[model samples]
Target: MSNPKTKFSVLMSIYYKETPEFFNKAMQSIWDNQTLKPDEIILVKDGPLTAKLDEVISIWQEKIPNILKVIALKSNLGLGDALNIGLKECSFNLVARMDTDDISMPDRFKKQIEIFKEKDIDICSSWAREFDGDETNIVSYKKVPKFHKNIIKFSKSRNPLNHPATMYKKEVVKNAGGYKKMLWFEDYYLWARMIINGAKFYNIQEPLVDMRAGFSQLKRRKGLKYALYELRFQKELLEIGFINIFEFIRNVTIRFIVRILPKNMVKCIYKLLRK
Candidate 1:
């Protein structure tokens, strides 16, 4: 049973490090450009933010403060914990996850919502256009599976869902134990858990989000410490039966090499191999 007029909530978290310009753009894309506006928006302030960030928030508050629910965390919890907190505050059965920097297209919500109304999907994500320097010079498009069976199979090797472009049933997430503190693998870990628990997943065939990409994105993926975190993620999946010990070791081996490689090399491989 689906409501054609179902109103959904947008869940987002903002930290001090994000630039105000990109933040404003993301906000404008959601509130000003979307074909169907969100009913409620649950935003978590991860920690103290700059004056510029505050000013941008204030502007949004002045525009539609009633539609916004702001939750402030005393300390900087990472995305997982912050989102877990925000989830409890969201008042909709359908919740759309939004990143602070990515821009959703005008019809993004309209199209996603229609799918929810027409299908039995527990989580629905979409393709994304990755851009760097400028949106005009779009580098690559991230295309994902359009069916549940394909998504589950793909999840064995890598995350099948596009995180920021996803709209999920809130109960599905809560039942999956909400998001956890998995360092860099928070979203992937949650998706993996949901899949093992028999959550139905889908992905739209068209790009609904413009993912911000560039040097900073590449920089975050390197280092020995990151490799260690990735290995920990794989081991947890093995313990949960999402992967076997053999698959776990193989994942760790590949992750260690990829995570420790130079940023330029990683970027080259991504651009060359990533479709």
Candidate 2:
């Protein structure tokens, strides 16, 4: 049953120039999830709408009466700015994040809200599978416990909560100053800021999303750029005292191993354990 007191606003910032099919899949997943239908579905089109995308959005707008607003940007602002605009327009107390090229499980929002109510958590997220074009090459992360201290441990290395799978209290986000216009990795920065502001986080141990990887422009960029971002991220975390030297070394080593491992092997291991 939907909780009337806990209305959720789902914010999807999309640029469907390349993969309209994936965007449709993502939106359908949310629409099909009956237990936790969003009070308002805020789709922020980050650039001028193409005919194909316009048709899709129009159909959805008519089919889903809950879709409260569609903000079509006249000019392209990057993802961070687009998300900020979406956040500003949300009317519900709980805000959920969605990505254009991912598939969310039907029970995602229901499970997240249940956790939020039970634990009084400010932010809730879940584990997700990374599918590299092929579903056969799906990989998942270890299930972290739902505690602020445990979550803070992984903050220095990589994002503890999958960005697309996260749901947060709207007021908590505003209090933390919302998303910043970082060059990249704005989600990670936002998580760090939220944690610093004494917001509690929880990760439901389930594969709530299937995120397609290695297809975006961000993935096509030179490997050196990603390395530089990680270096900067690590430095910032270290300065903030979230990670010690030993944890830092361990985290870096694990990431290195994942990079070299065969995609299929990683997928198999993850699926086996996740089940």
Candidate 3:
């Protein structure tokens, strides 16, 4: 059983481009489907949402009342900034990050809360299963190391945590500078800082959420622009002393090639690599 006293908040940001149907499903998972519901849900409107999106949100708001806190932005602030704003409104120390298009398993929050109760970690995230069009069609699993040492080492090369499935201590993240605008590498950069700051980490061995992914996600990872972003992000890692010169070169070289490869090749590589 989960501890009732260990209250947590679900922090989510939705922008105009997200599908209304997806957003509705996400809300159902966060509230209706959870075994252990959040004490509060901070939903950040990155910008003005479409009428359809607003309709879904409105229905949730009416259903949950005070538990659903909506923060509206005058214009789009992007995920990092939008989340930073939402963090300020969270009433609990533990905050779970949820993507607008993802589905949280019924036991996701319950299991995470149990881990927090038993462990001394500052952050905890579970493996996520990626599904293309629906939850039944799982494409891959995004798994991370289960302990702090392995997580630290893994951070030197790739992201050490699944951002959307993460539950982190609010003060620890804020002290580590919260989230920054690093294009596609925002979560990765934040993990680097947290690791450098000596924050403890842990990962559940099984998938706790279903992430929506497909070729569109892969497309965003390709192109010269994405390759440049990878280079810049890697350079930032070196500058911050999180990774040494050799690691920087190796990381950038491999990522650069992968980013510039044909989309079809990348897809094959992803399938081959992920379990």
Candidate 4:
């Protein structure tokens, strides 16, 4: 008998200027995982593809056969727009998110599929580790909140689920209106919408991917634009009753501590917790 729950599609949005080696590694990790091969892999190239990237993608297209679907965008649309395009093109009912620079564990899909079946969940995610160049460390080693109510509260300050480690029901995602083209923090915005619509969410308590850390465009910005975005989202949650006054204050306090702490101290604390 065919397993209904086994059908899944992995969506990855890529932009130009990414290292071809990292891109190859990310795709290879998905293909190498044996428990459940993705029925379709949607690769949305956000803008005009570079010669090297095109060659790298062409090789994978041939190697992976027709299961790999490549969509090249004529103009550069940000990550959020590219992801929306990929989501719309996904053929399977189960949609999993992947990053162009991350490495997934071999059993990542198998474990996520098992948990989705067992919990009958609409959205699922797992813990992840972080790497800075040659140095790697466990960033999170516990379960993220599962229930919609709890997840919303958790999202008031930090992103409750790792975007690259998430899988969701396509229908649920569509109903939530898919990814929004927010200036920054598209994933968090999508999660907020999903919770608003009462989607069931779960986080399997296991490390599933190695996410590259250090500075990115969003992290490099000055003037607290990202902080303002978080504050706006928190206000929205407050209006909807997801977080109370005390919880909001607590979340803000934690965010301040994280922002003010030195990088070495934060790493030290993370190491001590993992030990």
Best by lDDT: 3
TM-score winner among the candidates?
Answer: 3
- Model 2 weakest 10-residue run by lDDT: 214-223
Q: In candidate 1, which residue ranges exceed 4 Å CA deviation?
A: 1-4
* Model 3, span 1-275: residue lDDT tens: 84357889999999999999999899999889899999999999999989999998999999999899999999998999999999999999999999999999999999999999999999999899989886798889998999999989888898989999999999999999999999988899999999889999999999999999865677777878989989999999999999999999999898899988887899888987677
lDDT by residue (1-275, candidate 1, tens digit) is 84558889999999999989998899888989998999998989999999999899888888889887889899999999999999999999999999999899999999999898889889999999888867666888888889999998788878888899999999999899889989988999999989888899989999999989755576877899888888888989999999988888888888789888877788887886557
Q: In candidate 2, what are the lDDT values of residues 132-247, reduced to their tens digit?
A: 77645764443555577888876766677888999999889889888876666688888888888899988887778777763332234235555456656666666776677787
After the best TM-score superposition of candidate 3, give how far the Cα of residue 204 lies from its true spot, in angstroms: 0.2
Model 1 per-residue lDDT at 74: 91
lDDT of each: 0.89, 0.76, 0.92, 0.78
Candidate 4 or 2, higher lDDT: 4
On lDDT, who's better, 1 or 2? 1
RMSD of 4: 3.2
Off by over 4 Å in 3: 1-4
> Which sections of candidate 4 miss by over 4 Å?
1-5, 135-143, 146-152, 214-223, 235-275
Assess every candidate by TM-score: 0.96, 0.82, 0.97, 0.84
What's the true lDDT of residue 37 in model 1?
A: 96
RMSD, one per candidate, in order: 1.8, 3.9, 1.4, 3.2
Worst 10 residues of 1 by lDDT: 213-222
